[model samples]
Target: MDKPKAVTAAAHKLARLICSMLTQGEAYTDQGQVCCEERYRQCVLNKLNKRAQQLGMTLVPAAPAAQAG
Candidate 1:
């Protein structure tokens, strides 16, 4: 019943986070992209995971990359 609503809420939050990150290009290194620390990743994931849990949902884990021969 409320699943769709929950998903929508979480999606909006996640989208905003992504847009914010993308717009932070000026903050990135002049030579390349931003050098994020492990803590930053953990922080973002943790926050979104918590939000999802509150909404009775979970973020899907990314599939592993294929290996070369």
Candidate 2:
């Protein structure tokens, strides 16, 4: 089966995000850094929501995966 366009677009976005992290990712301790972290997190959530809508799906946080002993 062919991949859905929405998923392909999301994959492209995620790939770009990964590249950006490689160049800009770092731990920082400051108010501005904390705000930036929240901003980026929300931006990703927005993208996911958009994609989910496009695919006629709902988006929700998943429960933590169970770990095998």
Candidate 3:
């Protein structure tokens, strides 16, 4: 498989692992209930962003609303 395909597959595997861990309540830290939600979000986002760039797609930030004339 190519690099892009490999990355995509790895991302999917990571997502599935995260889901399984969540379902089993094994995704929390040792501090009882400390969740790494933000870390997971960043991980997924970073992977997707990298994939998008590799695909030659520009990930533009949302545009601000224009001021009324």
Candidate 4:
């Protein structure tokens, strides 16, 4: 969707979350940037893996880089 619709949809989601938290008497805790970034990375990887499996292929993790001599 376009920017306006996307913003509205996000606002609705945030409102619902806030409402649920209030009803449960819970506090809102921000999962810092690192946590959010890691979650997003995992989500992308999961989607990529699923697509690869559908194509009869597998994803292999890259080897750690070697230090310069």
With a 3 Å backbone cut-off (N, CA, C), the pairs that clash in candidate 3 are: none
The C-alpha lDDT values of all candidates are 0.80, 0.86, 0.82, 0.97
3 or 4: which has the higher TM-score?
4
Write one digit per residue (lDDT tens) for candidate 4, span 1-69.
999999999999999989989899999888899999999999999999999999999999999999999
Residue pair clashes in candidate 2: none
Cα RMSD of all models vs. native, in order, equals: 12.0, 11.8, 10.9, 1.6
Q: Which ten residues in a row have the lowest lDDT in candidate 2?
A: 25-34
TM-score of each: 0.40, 0.45, 0.38, 0.84
Candidate 1 lDDT score relative to the true structure = 0.80
Question: What is the lDDT for 46 in model 1?
Answer: 98
Model 3 over residues 11-63: C-alpha lDDT tens digits?
99889888988889786335432357767777988888999999998676689
Q: Can you write out model 2's per-residue Cα lDDT over 17-40, one digit (the tens) per residue?
A: 777777898543357888899999
Comparison by lDDT, 1 against 3, better one: 3
- Alpha-carbon lDDT of model 4: 0.97
By lDDT, the better pick of 2 and 3 is: 2
Measured by TM-score, how close is model 1 to the native structure? Answer: 0.40
Write the residue-wise lDDT of candidate 1 on 1-69 in tens digits: 499999999999878877877887534333433435666788999999999999999899999999998
List the candidate numbers ranked by lDDT, top first: 4, 2, 3, 1
Candidate whose lDDT is highest: 4
